[model samples]
Structure formats: structure tokens, C-alpha cells
Target: MPLYVWLACGLYWMNGMATVVLGSVLPLAVQHLHTTYVFGSDLVFLQFVGYWIGVPLSSMAVRRTGYRGAIVASSAITALASAGFTAWPKPLPYLVCSLANGIGMALMQATVSTSLIEWFPARRAVIMSRTEAAFGLGCVLGPLFASACIAAGRWQVAFALVAAAAAALAVVGAFTPMAARDSREGPRDAHTDAIHLANRRDRALVLALFMLCVLIYVGLESCVNNFLPAVFVEHFGLPATTASVAVSAFWAAMVAGRMATGWIARKLPYRPYLILAALGTLCTTVVLAATRSVVLGYVECVWLGLFMSGIYVVTLVFANHAFPDLTGLVTRLVTFFAGLGGATLPYAFGWTLAKTGSQWADVALALFAAVLFGVVGWTGWVTKRKSRSPSERVHAAG
Candidate 1:
């Protein structure tokens, strides 16, 4: 890996840090801002809207501006937005700030995903795993860090900290090697191909896999992360603090699982690896519905997290493999599905919980798992059939 890769990783770590902090602190923010819980979630909704909106276009910007430029732009935007959160006067300002952060994050995400996939070709899984592990670390630490910062009684200081981190990262990334890929030189994975979502070796399979992975991973993560605390409090008879612990363990286990996923995918193809992960998630989600024991229920949430991590990354990685010549294109398309999934499912899960018992959470999980299983199987089958014949592979890709 180049020094730039490491630097980009650092920037990405900090980038992810603020993203996690902002997302996790929504409830606290709502209280402090004197808004309803609806405002809290609307923040997530708006940010995701920005994210999904930028998914396709950011890759193009990276193509035009170069990877280093893309990263710098994303970092600057995110840092400024984080700082804006502190001084912004009202909910409208917060929403706009989040939207800006989301757009910058999407661009940065694409830049890093494109750059890192190329940096460690032989160790794709391990390298990507390490990157995701960093994201997990950010997710785990952001909430607690924000809490601590808030306790210090100056919330603006927290935003300022994120801004400083972003600016510093941007400086480092600007100096780092970008592995600049030119058209007609590097293969699909190396060039603007990551942006060409439609040109993978097995286009049909890629589409199906992308849809499945995004929906399943995002849905499950949002569902459990957002709503499970309430479930534990109500169904499992746990105190709010204990219930909160379940959410924490979920993220921690997700980080661990992502580490394991990267390690696992190195040797095994993502197809089966993702299948196993989804199956594991399905089993535990079912168990969550059945468990009455408070402690055991929280433990199941940990298992849920363990199974949740890396499934989406696997989708991105494998999609890159299918369209190695155009990873940027496919990565964006896949992530768009993933991001949309993340945005949409939490609402569905919340609705389910409100309308039915906590068992409804299991139902949602089951639906997500089922869709993913179907997509994976179909995509794998199509890819397998195409690989058997060079003409078929070429034709399918074309």
C-alpha cells in the first residue's frame, strides 16, 4: 500500500467518525434542540437523501477531479458541515448541514472505495476488511465520544473537533498518492469503471446482488440499531441503560464481524460468505423474536451485529470483482442501493414495532434475508453460468 493509502484511511476514519457521531446523537440532539423525535429521524432521512442523491454523481466528480481532489472536496465539505452544526440556528440549518455532510461523505466513500480496492489487489478482502474495521471503530466510538463532549457542556466544541479532524485529514490526503487511473489504461476496477454500474461481467447478477445486499444489510442494521433498544426495554423488561448496552454491543460485534468477513472473503468467494452471514443473521433475528430472557435477548442482538457486518461490503467487493474494470461505477450503484436500504428500512421496522409486537422486527429481518438470499443465489448462478463460456461472459457484460 502507498503512504497515500494509509493517509486516505486516516481521513476516512475521521470522516466516518463524525458521520457516526451525528447519526447516533440524534435523540440527544432532538432533546437539546427542543424538537420532536420526528426531527431526530428526519435528520437521518435527509442525510441519506443527500447520500443516495450523490452516489451516482460523485463517481463522476472523482473521475473528473481525480481521487485526491474528490477526497479533499469531501473532507472539506464534511468538516464545514460539522462546524455548521454548532453555529446553525435552527432545525433547518441542522438539516442542511446534514445534507452537506451526507453529500461529502458519499463522495469520500466512493473515492476511498475506488482507491483502496486498487491498492491491495492480492489482499482485497483483508485490506477492505481493515478499512471497514476502521469504520466500525468510528461507529463504536462516535456516540461515546460525543456523549463525553456533550457532558463537557459545549456541544459546539464537539462539532469543532470533527471539523479539525476533517481539515487535518484533507491535508494528509492531498499529499497522498491517488493511484490515478486514466481511461483506456487501467482496467475497469482501476479506472472510471466503478462508476459504470451497468457494465459488470454479469450485469443481471450484479444488479440482483447489489439490490439484495443493500436492502438486507442496511435494513437489518437500521432496524436493530434504531429500534431494538425499545424492544429490549419493553419485551425483555430491561432498563433503558441496559437496553442501550444492547445497541452498543451490536455495533461492536458488527466491527468484529466485519474484521472476520474480510478475513473470510480473502479465501472464500463473497457469494457463499455472504450467504453464510445472511443465514446467521436470519437465525439470530428469529431467536430475537422468541427470546423472553432479558440478558439472552441482548446477547442475541450481539449475534445480530456479528452477522450484520461485512455483508454490504462483500456486495461492493464482489461487485467490483464482477466489473473489475469499472469498480467505481459498480461501487456507487451498489452503495446507492445499500444507502437507500439503510434509509428506508428503519422506518419500516419502526412501523412494524409500533403496529405489532416486537416480533414484527423478526418479520422484517426475515423479509430482508429472504430477498438477499434470492438475489445472491440468482446472481451467483448467472455469474457461474457465464464464466463457463468466454462468449457468454463477454456478451452478458456487454
Candidate 2:
């Protein structure tokens, strides 16, 4: 692995920690702010709004300053905003910080994903899964880190720690030697380009499906990470400190799952992998909805994480494989929907939980999982159907 890859992985690791930091501290933060869960959900919504805005801006930033400059800028913004958490300690200020954090995280995410896909076109699935696994590793540790801070009765320190890490990453980005644009760009295969261009409608349809999948998938993931701790506390009667452990268990399972996926995905066809993942997620959600045992809830979280781990990366690689020449655009569009889903779904979950209770919230998640399963199935059918066309057959032979 190159130095750049290591740097990218480190950045993603920080991103994972930053992404979960709010969720980890949310229950405590709500109490600290003297606010309700609805406000916290709004914070989550605003943060993802920043993400929604940041995805396109990330492309512009990359165009203007290249990968290193964009990354450094993002890191600086994240660090500054995160530091505000300790300074203000008010509802409005915290919302502003969360929004800024989302933008910074989104920028870094788009930059890293595009850079890696360009740099290693042949091994996209393997590399993406591994980097995503690095992300999962950060998620695993983030809750534990926050749990420690909460245990010490200094929950604000979690954001402070995140700020320090972001600052250090900015310094790292400033010093690192990133590949030049021309060198990093992958070659465009003429045959593949022609096949896609000739079937413009099919290509559009597939891209739309892919985007929809990303939207729902990301929303589902955000809901789980952000609300699972809350569920543990309110429904399972677990303490805040103990509830955070469920998040750790969930992400720990994701890390293991993604590591295995990086290898297994190379052999497994995209269609089956996606279908099975969705099916597994649906089953886990059902089990989670029905189970009342605290131990079973924790175990179900791990199972759910394992099932959901590879969907994003695998879908990303699958999309790029279908449209090789538009890696940057495809990445941006996918992540844009990702931000959209993350913003909307979790807010809805929070609202639902605030009003109806955890049982209904669990039903909502299971329903979403079922929809995701259906979407994945539809996407697979479309892709397979397109492949069987005469033009595709000729391209495959040639």
C-alpha cells in the first residue's frame, strides 16, 4: 500500500469517529443542553444538510485545489467547528457545530472515495471494502471513547478530542505528497465507454436505481448508529454508559464483516452479494423488532451491522464497473443521495421515537429494510437484463 492509501485510510478512520461522536454523546448532550430528543434529531438533520451541501462543493474544491488542498481545508473546518462544542455549550451553537462537522466529513468522504477509485481502478472492490473497514474500525472505537468521556462526567471532551484529531490530520494532509491529477486519473476503456453511451436510457435508469439504493442504505445506517443507543436506554432500561456499548458491538461486527467482504466480494458476483446482504438486513431488522432481551438486542445489533456492512462499498464498486468513465460524477451523485438519506431518515426516526415510542420505531426500521431488499432485487434484475442485450453480448465477446 502507498503512503497516500494509508493517509486516506487514516482520514476515513477519523471520519468514522467524527461521524459517530454526536450519536455517542447525544443522550448525555440532550441532558446537558436541557433539551429534548427532538432537538437532538434536528441537530442530526442539520448536520446531514451540511453533508447534502458539501458533496457537490467537494467536487468544486477538488477542481480548484486538488485532493490535498481539499482534504486540508476540510480538516481545518472540522477541527474549528468541533472545538466550538466546548466553547458554547448552547443548543444553537451545538447545531452549528454539527452542521459544520457534517460538511467537513462529507467533503473528506467524497475526496477520499474519488481519489482511491481513480488510483486503483482494477482493485476497487477490495480497496473500497478495506477502506470502509477502516471506517468501521473507527466507528467501533468512537462509542467506547465517548463512553469513557461520559463515564468521567465530561461528555464535552469527546468533541474536544475529535477536534484535536482533526487538527493533527490537517497537519498530516499539509505535509503529505499527493499524486498529481493526471497520474491519478484512470484510463477510460473505449469499449466500455461505447457500450454505456450507446444505451443512454439504460445507463440513466441504472444510475437512478443505484442512487436510490444509496439513499435508503445510508439512511438506514445513520438511523441505526444514531438511535440504537437511545433504544437501549429507553426501551431496554440500560444506562447511558452501557447503551454506548451496543454501538461498539455493532461497529465491531461491521469491521469484521467488511474485512471479510473485501476478499469475498472479489469472488461473489455483485448481484448475489447485494441481494443476500439486503435479505440478511431485512431478517436482522425483523429479529430486532421482536426481541425484548437486552442480550439479544446487543447480539442483534452485531448481526445487523454485519449484514449491512458491505452494501455501500459493493454498490459503489458495482456502479463504477457499469460506468467506468464517470467515476467522479458517479461518486459525487451517490454520496449526495447518501447525505440526503442520512439527513432525512434519522430525523424521521428520532421524531417517530419521540412521539410513538421504540416499538413503532423498530417497525419503521424493519419496513425500510424490506424496501431496501426490494430495491436491491430490482437493481440486480435491471443489471442482469441489460447485460443480456445484444450490444452487451457483443462487447463482452470483443
TM-score of each: 0.81, 0.94
Q: Give one digit per residue, the lDDT tens place, for model 1 in 1-398.
A: 54665676576567557666664444456567897545645666677676786676677776798777888888888888888987873789998997887787777887787777765554556667767777776666655566566566554555777788888888877776666432232212211112223344447645665666676677566666555556665576654444545666777887898777755764676666767777787778777777778778768867877877877777777777767776556767766775687677766665566567667666776777666666666766655554445555578779
- Model 2 / residue 302 / CA error / Å: 0.8
For model 2, how does the per-residue alpha-carbon lDDT over 1-398 read when each residue is reduced to its tens digit? Answer: 66777888888888888888789888988888898889978998988998887898899999999998999988988888889986888998998998998899999999989998887776777778878998998899889999999999988888887788889999999888887333434322222222233567878889999999999999999998888899888888889999999889999999999998877775786778899999999999999999999999999999999999999998898888888889999988888999999999999999998899889999999988999999999998878767576766788889
Model 1's alpha-carbon lDDT is: 0.67
Q: What's the residue-level lDDT of 302 in candidate 1?
A: 78
Give the runs in model 2 whose Cα sits over 4 Å from its true position.
Answer: 180-197, 389-398
Best by TM-score: 2
